[model samples]
Target: MALLQLVLVLCAWWRPSAPAALPAHAINGTSPAASATVSDSRVRQERSVLTNYGGSVGLSPYFADLQGRPSPTPPTLTTELTPPPPKCMDEETCNPLARYRTISGRCNNLQSPHHGTPGQAMHTLLPQRYDSPAVFRMRAVGGGLLPNPRHVSLLMSLAPEGAKVEGNSLFVQMGQFIDHDFSITTTVREMTPGGKSVEVDCTACSSWYNPACAPIPVPLNDPYQPPHLPTGERRCLPMTRSVGYLVKDSQGRPVLSQPNFNTAFLDVSPVYGSNRCTAEDLRLHRDGMLESDENHLLTKRPADDFPLCFTEAGYCLHSGDKRVNENVGLTSIPHWSDERLYQEARRINIAQFQNFVYGEYVPLLLGYHTAAKMQLMPNHEGYFLGYDPTIDPGVYNEFSTAAFRMGHSQVPKYITFMNDKYEVTYHIPLHYAFFNNTMLALGNVFDPLVRGLLGVSMRPTDLKLVDSLGNKLFMEKGDPHSGRDLFALNVARGRDHGLAPYVEYLKMCGVKEEVSSFADLESLMRPESLALLARAYEDVRDIDLFSGGLAEVPLPGSLIGDRFWFESPAAGFTHAQLQSIRRVTLASVICGVLDQRNPRIPVHALQTPHPQSNPERRCSELLTVDLELWRETPHSPSPPCTHQGQSYQEGALVPVSPCLACVCQPGGKMRCQCDLSGCKQTQAAEDCYCRRICGYSTPHLKPQYRQ
Candidate 1:
């Protein structure tokens, strides 16, 4: 019943509506005079509505109800409800001419400023499957308690050794780096009488009373964990629920949704920081450069400033993303003096980062074929005209919680360090590297670590996790059991987020098999993996998303399965700008950072150094982004062209009609070409108006057509 109610609410929220046409002034980069029909206040209000609530104008009535106001009267088929736009939307503003993204990640999509902003709720691919409307999914399909996450982790994730993949450890490192760039779930905390927030300690009790506490209960006789105490108490790994907001379902019951602290785009938020304050803190405030030590490494923070730092140097390395301090290789990020230079530098860096992700990183991770299939690959030339503002580009819950977690399986037991000659110098166990920056701060270890990453092969994507992660994750120096099971935490986190079961995601990804029994998953999963899952889960339908997804057979030439592969939005770049950005490669970025002479690395940095396919290449051979393309040109006013009743600037795509391709030309001219392939030709050509707007096709329209 709860699921049904949640689905109904989501259905109402997601109901499709025709997006309003962009204002002529906004589209043509012209003065308000060009669109005199729309008042400035009205335009601002409309933009505010779109930005705050997404492109779905159908949500106005719901918003009214959500604000504790009387629900607006239902609209008839011919009319729509016109609720007063929220006051917050009226106050929210954007500068359409700004070239750089805001530090808060707002205004990237002009029509929807807050679409991918930090602290916004994550997009849900499917309706959440909570045990209750606002509770974690703790019950199995048979109305019994679900299997303990620790038990599942022990049965499925333990491996003596991990198999190596064709890619180097740098691939796994890059994945982790990119993962931090977008999604960071902030956990809930409690406040004291003085209003200071404190961490909710779930470890102090076997049964937690705090709603935020959802710690993993260590099962009895666990291989690595001690047995239950003489007082009949069990150990629990400390955990807290992610910070979330409660909204009303169709039945007026509360539904919890978690927010993502990072922006959804691949804008390198980890390097630049997610918000204005943090970005400013990391900046040197001169010449557009960030703070760094004399050696050009990240600036160190006072030991007392960082909660996780345990280094003897009485300080920890500071970064835009705090997680970078977890390991030595993880630290990876410029300038001009004027404010213009800072913005310009940020613009180019973001462009180059996007280019490498789409051009090299994604293709290698998803396999070139699959990447191309999903349209994730950038065009070698010409403008990418696939920008759609209506699409909510927020990170999906499934992707953040389950699919992207596949990298945890690829983590090697140790982080190896090698000399310039590629000779193994030393190694640090993965457990010891956590929260300890001693290895990074110790004399000249960064270069050796980079070499090791480039030289060592990463573990293949499989169900088995390395012993360090499966047994002693985040384990301190001497206490063998003073650690948590990462694999189990991953399982529990999914439930905390109320993610759907593995089978649901499989169906969503278009898997053909009807999975009623364990045997049905044989074609997709290994026999041993299936058996392990069978032993851990009560039913096939009850399998956690993270567990089942990791067990699936990897797609050909890809490290992950089909369900884990997802498409990212295209970078909205002009023809010349995009072409220049595409020149950037991961090798080039690495070369720019490495303080070495003639650093030789694989042309395809994400793959192993194959003699032929991915041959070793000097730093000079790698293609770097040409920042000259980003140089600011003085604004020169151009004449606007009028088409029908709208105005457009030269070279602008005119919104004449969907089936018609129209562009404004120089000298106040309008050029339109019609493609009626999907339209039925009637005796009266003028009466048959076939509409295809933003990929949505409408068969026939009357002569009185309006875009």
Candidate 2:
């Protein structure tokens, strides 16, 4: 019965339980007294009405009926959590000097070629792996006039096949495609002028992995281009790495390893496999003249295959012979002239790039802390950007020494080097070897030595020159020759596709003013005059004096001819005095007026300052009018290379100065005949004074001030 009742209750609750239950009660005839049953039924009907208004028929309302009650305050949110960053392999570390202590675990010195995450490599360049990285110590070596410590890099080259090495001399092997194969021969300790190493030794033996190897050289001869391969094909030279010892006695002659003073090598090269002979049908690669020992550039030579160890001032054995010194007139190459101990021996540091496209070529000399050291430092690594046929190869090698953050992607670094010669380019993968750890290299030297005395910071806009009183000495239309001439932001140069919005804003704010002629502009825009205007505005609250509001104050003109030259109708004096001021003041003008209609047509005064000959005296300024921009034929490429493109327009800033100061007249009072009158005597007499007699020239007496 309980089960049946429960089931009936459940069914009633499904659809308006109160009405269903009431009907069941009535059917059962157990309806409380009829009036009580009617009251109960009314209650059930009220509940049904309440349920419809409060919620859907059978649902419960979340809130109570207290509409006037105060609402609870919303909970406050506080802390926010950030996700952790990803981890990089230990070998791919940055700045090994300071941060190396924190890193743990064995690291592979063989860096990945792709410059990606360490250990998880995209590809490997070498096949064989070494057990431990080679260690070399550098100490300050001494040389003639050489001073300051240097972190120097070294490289070597391969002599062509059939090249003979006899008694410390290497003879070139002549043939086709026999170019030099350069590689980092060894690294030495920082050497200072007059600093001698007391002792030097090498320890911790190791063997080179993958033992670098290459194919033999092929003959150069294209049947289509003439000049067949001469001397036939030559086999690729064999190479080896080992540790060797050499001792020298007091007589400077080679001796077997003796106890007193001797040199031991960490790694040395022994003769490897027999040379490979070339075939008659061998094809030759062009000799590019790219490899060199002085610059640390490699040409297909394996890394560390041939290592050398030298005892301070002692001889090195088992190494390729050094070429004769051409500049110093010495038959021997550069060698350390000292007697001392070295912590470690020297090893080669090799680097290469596949699919290398070259553009600008710059011979880079290592930046040293001191001038003395700069003198001793050898030039290493000619960095440049790679460009082939199209562009002029602007940007060179990009190197970023920035620390590698966990999440941020690697940034492309930039190396800009320019001189008169051509440019070249190369790229560095962000691997352990080439992580742009220059900051770490910089840290090796003292901070005081590394930080430049000159500090430079650049903004999009040029700096505004202000005086001690916070007065702007230079304005948009101010003179460029004045000491107050601040470098203004050049807006036209910032039209490239990658510029930021703020740069455009600056360019807009610094617009060039329109002018009729350069002469008119310069008279009003001279640096000194602008400086005075800036000072006047700064000293006084109103800047109207400089804002074209106040009338120009007339400065006393120098005495000339019959009377003092004064501005007639001074209102237009500035416009008239543009280049004509030479007749009034002995001082020459320096500003110019640029013709707006035709930018190529420039009109200005030429005033060259002679500091040495004319100590205090100055001559009259000259008027200069430009007709057109000059042009020259672009530089022609060398023989066999045709001119690639037409010449581009280039602009130049040329200054023209006055030739003479004074003009002479016959039977007339002294007159200042400037270019204004075109130096025409007849016209000059009209504008300039010609000894006017005022009451007989007032007895021809000099003024009191002049007397």
Candidate 3:
């Protein structure tokens, strides 16, 4: 009798309570009780389908397509499929005259309100080439199975040592920082009857039997990975397909397409957040400043917020992008004041960021010749009149998935920490810094890490990746076998997206006219690279876009190949604003957050420092954007001033000589000052102030005076 009573009590205690009902607003028009009834029935039906395939219902269509077999009958649902609700555009909320950009990126193009908004489909540069209508590309040109992604990675991605490049590590870091601002693909997640979403674990299922399982099986006697499992099974790297939905093409045929979780603009969405809700959460709601910790670093999230963090602090830094905590330099946040001042500061910061991307970053990545030839460089003077709303600014799938991934090759094996004299103090292996912030929380290592980035050169962009990335990426402590190969993952993701072959992109970019055989690429690729490609792929047309793109030689001085070079749209700014933005540089932006006492830095921070060509100088010597150009006139009536036979409102920049900039002051007066402050001066005339007969020749000279 006692044992029976104890068992009954334990069973009652362990019983879970029923899940709460969802609100009617969450399900559009359905009532709460009706939604619950329908949801319970739907869960049963979905679970039946999942059980039939051993928990891989999501991948059924893909396998059927690959095997040329009919798709399994889907379980009948109690409810009918309904179209999504129409998008509601609140004009008052998205004002055209508003100086700041919307958090959701809506109304960026007034003509097409949802052009660059999040959750929109990424633009396809060319037609997708899938093995079937809805399945991934799995067959070669001659109908044979394509080479395994792991085999391709092992043959092409390993290197004895990294080749050095002329650019500094900051160049690679900034590229990754900007790439996050462009596109982030969503992955599939299963929802339970309790309304909880969880990841679908494909690794526990049989390979290729479950539609969601696209595991890369390791070849026999692999160099890095274990040859076999303890149970005598083959080892496989797990990966899942990106979330996609079926859409009709021009011919009314269904095609698979992926959505970009991020807005397709370079608007610093990484710092500001992509959606209004996320943006609101990141703000302090006081003085228009972002929330930060006492140490001026990004604030830490709650203990239960990020379970992936494995540090003693038990939490990770919070930001619009999770990758922000990867490095210390990106974690620094700026303090702000009033609403107007905050808006003005954000505007100036974005303008300077855009200016740096075009004026310096793009030129170095694409080379000055290619950038100019493609008309991708910014104007030195006057306003940019090329703002066309008709051109969609959505990110291209080709660029995000394959071309921009070239940055992976530039990652060094280890991150170095240095002192004021550029001597190494200590270093950490690249894998140790992944998703771990223990080193950043200890003492004062931020400045030293930043100095190391500016002082050290990055590896050359090529086919080879470091051992840390190719063999031991994201490896946990004390576990040598708990790592994934990033190179293999990249190749697998390309096929999962059904992207076109490398030759197609080459033809689209006009890099090659005829690519019938591997011999045609002799001029563009080295002999060893060609041999490796031939060994991995059965045919020339079956090459993966990532593998082929990385194998080619970089264009003259550019870090990437011709296929990666594309023109970026210019932002809408006034003539005075453009002039001010043109003065901004990477060196100036880095200096803004550093300790004022030790503001010494390289003249060109993106390039490796040279004593004569690119020398170290005080931050004061760097040119920066003038925020006075963004000052707005008060609504109250104010007296106007005239300068150079033109009337201007208060706080407006007056048209004057190239070397002199005059601003309209209060009480109807004009204040004129020399724009070139740090230049060597020579008296040319009595009232003309300082003018040099030799002209401006310093590194800090204005963009217009660079020639």
Candidate 4:
């Protein structure tokens, strides 16, 4: 009973504990100090507790045990939230090839004439189509080489335009795939067989230009240097021959300096021979020129294939080949239904001009009489033949029709005429290849047609590949290097419908099999590259500024995986390779692709202004005025530039000195103060005197006194 009573007492006491109390005085607020004392006491107590037990980890065993007890429910584990991967960089969101397809779509969206808008009407154009299945099986082909249905139709219109397609017995369609609309009008005052010269107007001639193309004046000023004499007198003198060709220097004057006549250095050589012309055959091909008389020369016959002979001097009478039809007999080819006077005239003129300029002087000066000898085929087409007797089998300087489309000015009649005929050649593919070669041979610069064909987002030097997944396939190296092999590599992968036709062309050229794999594709395409490389001018090899202007297409970095950013050989960039790439355009690109598909295809440049019977005599006559002028007045020495305090003698560059007119002594500041009167002087007066010794006081010696 007592224990029970005690337990009850303990329970009642444990029910609640009394709160810590302040002093009675502090509670009653008797004295402010007393209240402060109570507060201080509390503060001391808290400080002691904190100081005695460093931190939670350093707490006493009792506190540790109290906190260490496990919770009824286990603690839940937590994880970090992460973000999703970035969207594919390329629009197509797949690979480089996929990206290219997307880019192509976007390019089409850019809306240009070449791209053609949706619903745009296309004419029914079905030109002749030729194919060679032996060389190509038609797998992995791209649209680069083959013309789209639209393009194919356009090529067919050449038939009505009076053009002929012929080669290796292949009935190919005639017409340029991408020629400028041009017109060439030649009014030749010809000496008729009746001993009377008649002026004939040949306006219906076909050329790279539109029939409406108007003649523009050609600035006759020398492209290399200013005329030694006054402009008028310069025009009067005969053209200056290449210095190396001359036995004596400029007539009476001693050769100031012999020019580097090393054609080897210039990289000019016959296509069939050595630079030295060592072999008799090579010598013949080197000296002689390719002169076509009758369209029969177009025959694939071995005899007609034989190159004509020529002399060291520019002449057409060198080779006595009997099969020559134009000069000998005006016979037509078996297929040609009509001997169109226009076509005949054009062929004659081209052949004649080639014969005329074979070894003749390439006038160094512009507008000189000898300048007439320079029948620069305005466009790349036809050949330059030497007619001289000693050298047989003349050199054939072939060019591309694309060349004819470039450069605007008064194209010489001879060039204009040759351009017309070459353009009409049915062997467009092969002719084009030759034309491209010829331009390089002529040291002519290639001007690409720029129309933002590629988007502005990409540069011309941008490396691009077709990502199979629709992502831009960029190169690993990036920038300029991208253009390096991208052209060749992509060309290797890309295909077009026209590829089969191209293969057929190769078969015609004696190629056994069509390009099969990328390796074979590269091998087939290598010739064109080699051709371009062969023609590469060492002088212009520094492709700095020229390459910077080419159009580039951005590609994905990698072909596989989600990362579009590529770092590969395709991405490599360099200024030199880019310069070469810049020379590429849709037309050139198309041509290259076509060449890969069909090796040795020809694309012809038009030959305008038909050659006459005696191109040599006429060319010589053209130089009469200039030659007489040179005889009248030789080049005089340049006058010396005289100026005060500076001596600029003849043949020396003009001197340019900074204004050092201010006079300073010792550590004095170099101040330039002009006279107010002189500041208002005319420019001429200032140039004559003010900028020289006119202004500034001489430094006066400081007075020194001995101590």
Q: Report the alpha-carbon TM-score of model 1 versus the true structure.
A: 0.74
lDDT of 3: 0.60
lDDT of 3 by residue, 480-556 (tens): 77677788888888887778999888888898977889988888887778877886676889898999988888888
Candidate 2 residues 89-164, lDDT tens each? Answer: 2434433122111111111111211121111211111111111111100011121110000000000000011111
Candidate 1, 1-707: lDDT as tens digits? 01011111111111111112111122223332210122334323321231121122211221111112232222221111111111112124776544456766677777777777777788788888665523666667875556667667876753233245577777787787788888988666666687755655666333244566665655434556764444555456666666666665566654567788787777666676777777778776654556666655566789777545556567766652211222121111112234545555565566666666777778877888999999888677544434556677889999999899998888766666677666666555565566656545544555666677777778888777776677777677667776887888888889878888889877877994467888889998888788778867758998999999888877888888010011111232334445656776767666654558878877877776778887888898777655444343236444677767778655455655545545555455655555343233342233233433222233333333333
lDDT of 4 by residue, 22-54 (tens): 111212234222100112233223212311222
Candidate achieving higher lDDT, 1 or 4: 1
What is the descending lDDT order? Answer: 3, 1, 4, 2
The positional error of residue 64 in candidate 2, measured at the CA in angstroms, is 85
Q: How many steric clashes does model 3 contain?
A: 1
**By the lDDT metric, which is better: model 2 or model 4?**
4
Off by over 4 Å in 4: 1-279, 282-546, 551-707
RMSD of 4: 43.8
Q: On TM-score, who's better, 1 or 4?
A: 1
User: Residue 476 deviation, candidate 4, in Å?
Assistant: 26
